[model samples]
Target: MASSLTKDSSGIPGSEKTFFGHPRGLATLFMTEMWERFSFYGMRALLPLYLVSGGTAAAGGSQGGGLAMTAATATAIYSIYLAMVYLLAMPGGWFGDRVWGPRRTVAISASVIMLGHLTLALPGQGAFFAGLALVALGSGLLKANISTMVGHLYDGPDDPRRDGGFTVFYMGINLGAFAAPLVIGTVGQQVGWHLGFALAAVGMGLGLVQFLYGTRHLNPRSGLVPEPLTREERNRVLRRTVLVVLAAAVFYGVVVVAGLYTMNWALVPITVAGLLIPVAVLVRIKRDRELSDGEQSRMTGYIWFFAAAAVFWMIYDQGGSTLAIFAADKTDTSVFGWSFPASWFQSVNPVLIMALAPLLAWIWLYLARRAKEPSTVVKFAAGLALVGLSFFLFILPLSAAGGGKVGPLWLVGIYLLQTVGELCLSPVGLSVTTKMAPAKYASQMLGVWFLAVTAGDCVTGLLSLAGVDLNTTGVVALEAAVAALAGIGVYAYRGKVRTLMGRVH
Candidate 1:
C-alpha cells in the first residue's frame, strides 16, 4: 500500500534541483497558490459590497448588481460563507489523505472554483448562491492540502529551511492577495460585477494550468495518499460520503421549502459546530492512551496557542466585511478628485504583507542566530495585542468625525498595525503546528488550526449582528478591549505554556 502511494525518483528528471536553496517544487507550489489566492481574495473583496448594493431602479441599481441586502444580512451571509470555507478543511484534508491525494484533490478543487466564479458571472440570485457554495467547498479542499504538500517537500521535520520555505509560500499568498482587489475590485465596483467575477475565473484557470504543468517537477511523494485504503475500505468510505452529501442536500431543500432558509439560521448551527468540533477532537485526543507524555503536553499547549490565534483572526478578518463597509460609507477615498472602489482598500493588508514578510523572516533568522528569538507563545500574545491596538487606533478619527467620513489614512493605519499582527502570528502558527503535532495527528492538528479561523469568523458574524448599528468608534473600542484583555491573559501564562511545549521551541 505504501509503495502504491509513493513514486520512485527514477521516473522524473530535474526533480532534485534547488530553487533559492529550497526544493524546486517550491516554485511551482508558490505560483499555484499565488493565482489561487488571486481568485479567492478577489471574489471576497467584492462579496460584501455586492451584497449591500441595491438592485431596484429607485435604489440606484446597476446592471446585474446587488441583492438589496441589509448590512446585517450581508454580514451574516459573509460570515457564514467564510466560516464554512475554513470549517470544511478537516473533511477535505481527510479526503486527500485517505482517498485522492493532494494533487488530484487540488486539481478537482481548482476546476470547481473556476466553475463557481463562472456561475457567479451569470445573471440571477440562484447562480450567485450556487457560486458561493461551490467556491467555499473548493477552497476548503485546496487550502490545507497545498500546505501539507509544502511540508512534504522537506526531507524531515527538523529541517531548518522549513520555516523559511513557508514564509516564501506565504508571500506568494499575499502577492496574489495584493493584486486581486486592485484589479477585480475596480472592475467589479466600477465596470460591472459580473465582469469582475469572470476575471476571477480567468485567474483560477491560469493557476490550474500552471499546477498541471508543474506537477512533474514536484517531489515524487507530493500528491501521494498518506494511507492507501483497501478496496473494501475505499468502497465503504465512498458510500458514506455520498450518503452525507445526500442528507445535507435533503435537509437544505426542506429548510428552503419551509421558509426557514435565512442566513441567520445557517449561521447558528455552523457557528456552534465550528466552536465545538476542535474541543471534541481535543477531548478525544486526551483520552487516547497511545500518546506519549511529551506528545500529550505539546497538544495541551497547542490549545492555548490555538485560542490566541482565534482571537487574532476574529479581529483581523474584519477587513473583508465590516471594515469594507466602513471604507465605503465612512472613509474619504478620493484621490486627485476621483473616488476609488471601497473594495480596493482590501488590497492594503496583502500589499503590506508582501513588503514586510521578508523583513520578518530576516528578523526571525537574526534572532535565532543570536539565541534571542521569542517563543511561539510570546509571538502569539504579541500578535493579539497588535491587533487590539489596531482597532483602538480607530477611536480618535471615529470620535472626531461624529458620523462623518474620515481620512483614508485612518484605515491605512489600522491595516498597517493589523498586518504587523498577522506577520507575528499567522506564519508562526503554521510552522509551529508542524513542529509540535504528533506524527499520527499532524494533518488533523493543522485542520484544527484552520478551525480557529472558522470560529473567529463565526464570532465576527455574531458581533456584526449585535453591534452593526452602534457608533463605529464604540464598536472598534469594544473589540479592542476584548482582544487586549485576551492578549494580556495569554502573556501572563506564556511562561508556563512554553514549559508545557517541551522541546518544540
Candidate 2:
C-alpha cells in the first residue's frame, strides 16, 4: 500500500528537493490546481448572484441578467450543484483506483472539465444546466485523484512534511480563487455573465495544458493501477452502471410525464443520496473482511472526524449562497468612495488564505519540532469554533442594522475568521485522509473524505427547501450554536478518537 501511495525520494524530479524543499511535482500539481480553481471559483462567485438577479435590468443590464429565479430556487440549485460535485468524488476515486491510474484519470478528467466550461459559455437555459452537469462530472473525476497523486509525491506514510505540502497546494487553490472574482466576477456582474463563463472556460483550458506539460515531473507510480479489476469484475461493474443509468432515465421520464417534476422535487433525491452515501461507505469499510481490526478501529475514529467536517463545511460553504446574498443585498460594498462588486467578497477568504497559509504551515512545523503539536482532533475543534464564531459576529451587525445595510468590514471579519477555520481543518483533513486510508481502497478513502462536504451541502440545500430565512438573526445564532457545540463535543472526546486511530497520528 505504501509503495502504491508514496514515491521514493529517488523518484523526485532530479532528487534535488526543489519546489519549496519538497518534490518538484508539487509545483506542477500546485499550478494545475490553481487554474482549475480559478475556473471553478470564477463561475461559483457569480452563480448565486446571477440566479437571484430575477432577470431584472435593475440588478444588471438585460444582457447581464439572470434566470430570474426566486431566492429559494437559487439556493436549492447552488446547494445541489455543490453537493453533486463532491458526491461524484466517490465514484471518481473508484475509477482512479481500479480503472485508470491517478495520473491518467486527472488528465482525462481535466479535458472533460474544459469542455464543461466551454459548454457553459453558450447561451440558453438548456446550455446552462448541461454545462453545470459537465463541470460537476469533470470536477468529481479530477478532485480526489489529483490529491492522491500529490500524496504519491511524498516519501512515506508518516512523512513529517505531508501537512505542510498540502497547505502549499491549498495556497495554489486560494491564489486562483483570489484572482477569479476580480476578473470573472466583475465581468459577470458588469459586462455579461456568458462572457464571464467564457473566461472561466479559458482558465480550465490553460490548466489542462499546464497539467499535460508537467506530467514528466509527477511520480511514475501515479500511472499504475494499484489493484486492477479482473475481466469478470469489469463486466459486472459495466452491467451495473448501465442498469443504474437506465433506471435513472426511466425514473426521470416518469416524473416529467406525470407532471411531478419541479426543481425542488428534483433536488430531494440528490439531497437524500448525498446524506446517505457517506454512511453507506463507512458501513462498507467497517464490514470489509479485507481490513484488519486496527484498520477498522481507525475507521471508527474517522467517523467522528467525518461528522465534524460535515458540520464545518455546512456552515463554511454558505459563504457562496447565503453570505453572497447578504453581501449583495444587505452589506455596503463601498471603500474609499468606490463601490465594489458583491461577488468580490468571494475573493476575501482566498486572499486571507494566501497571506496566512504559509504562516500556519510554519507554525505547524515549528510546533511539531517540539513534540507539542496539537492532535488533528483539536485542530478540527478549533476550526469548527472559529467558523461558528464568524457567524456569531454576524448577529450584532444584522440585528443592529434593522433591515438596513451594514459596513463591509463586518463581512471581511467573518471571512477572516472562516479563513482561519479553513486553515485548521481543510488541508489537515486532506493529509490525514492519505495517512489513514486502507491500501486496497486508498483513493476511495479520499473520495469518502469529500463525502463530508457533500453531506454538508446536502443539508444546506435541505435548509433552503425548508425555507429557513438565512438573513434572520435567529437562524444565524442557531447555526453558530450548532458549530460551537459540535466543536466542544469533539474536543471533549479527543482522547477516545486518538485511541481509535491506533498508530496513525
Best by lDDT: 2
lDDT of candidate 2 vs native? 0.85
Number of clashing residue pairs in every model?
Answer: 0, 1
Every model's TM-score: 0.89, 0.89
lDDT of 1 by residue, 322-344 (tens): 77876776777878798777788
Model 2 misplaced regions, further than 4 Å: 1-26, 55-64, 151-168, 289-291, 365-372, 435-440
Please, what are the lDDT tens digits per residue for candidate 2 over residues 214-270? 889898989999888999999999999999999999999998999988776667887
lDDT of 1 at 180: 98
Worst 10 residues of 2 by lDDT: 1-10
